[model samples]
Target: MIQQPFFTPAILLVLFAIPLALGWVPRNRFYGIRTRRALADDAAWYRINRSGAWCLIVSGLFYLAVAWVVPMSGPQDVNFRLWLLHLFAFVLPLLLGLVRIRHLSRQD
Candidate 1:
């Protein structure tokens, strides 16, 4: 069995968001944006989610790359590094999404 990487948030986010970015996933309360502005209309939902998806994809890839490049030694050190990278994986995409949302909202 192929061992799955412990850190898979990046990969999972990339996989989940790509379809949404491509418009394959319809706007819904379950998956897409639940924000007032994004849920205000279908168009806004698509636009904001599309941008958010791309941001997530990019951030995920970045986290994956960084994790791959940084060599981790033993369990103790690996855990710390992994935690930091995981935090980055979550935060960077969120910041990017916020920036994208600001830009998209301005267009309206």
Candidate 2:
């Protein structure tokens, strides 16, 4: 059986979210949502960042669910399954978060 480190994504996402979720991060080019609208306004920065952080939390929970319910297959199928898992775990929430941010930042 192949050993799978299925918890990595959730851990990473949650770790990334802590600062943003808590409003510990300031508006800057290096971190958080640095979109023109988010960067330009202090309020938008915190709101958008918090929303994005929630997205990360949601994504991490989804990862935990996937890890629990997903069945591992033989070695031959491991690579493909891992790839698909990564795509679903990361891409869906990211796209949703970006769409949310786009709408939010445009509002004000």
Best by lDDT: 2
* Stretches of candidate 1 exceeding 4 Å from the true structure: 1-6, 74-86, 102-107
lDDT (C-alpha) at residue 41 in model 2: 86
Off by over 4 Å in 2: 1-6, 71-86
Q: Tens digits of per-residue lDDT for model 2 on 1-108? A: 123344665677788888998999999999887788889989989998898888777877776666566745534455785758755765687677778767877886
- How does each model score on TM-score? 0.72, 0.75
- Among the numbered candidates, top TM-score falls to 2
* C-alpha root-mean-square deviation, each candidate: 3.5, 3.2
Q: How would you encode candidate 1's per-residue C-alpha lDDT over 1-108 as one tens digit per residue?
A: 012143466678789889878987776779864577777788888888888788878877776666566634534454765667656655776687668767776576
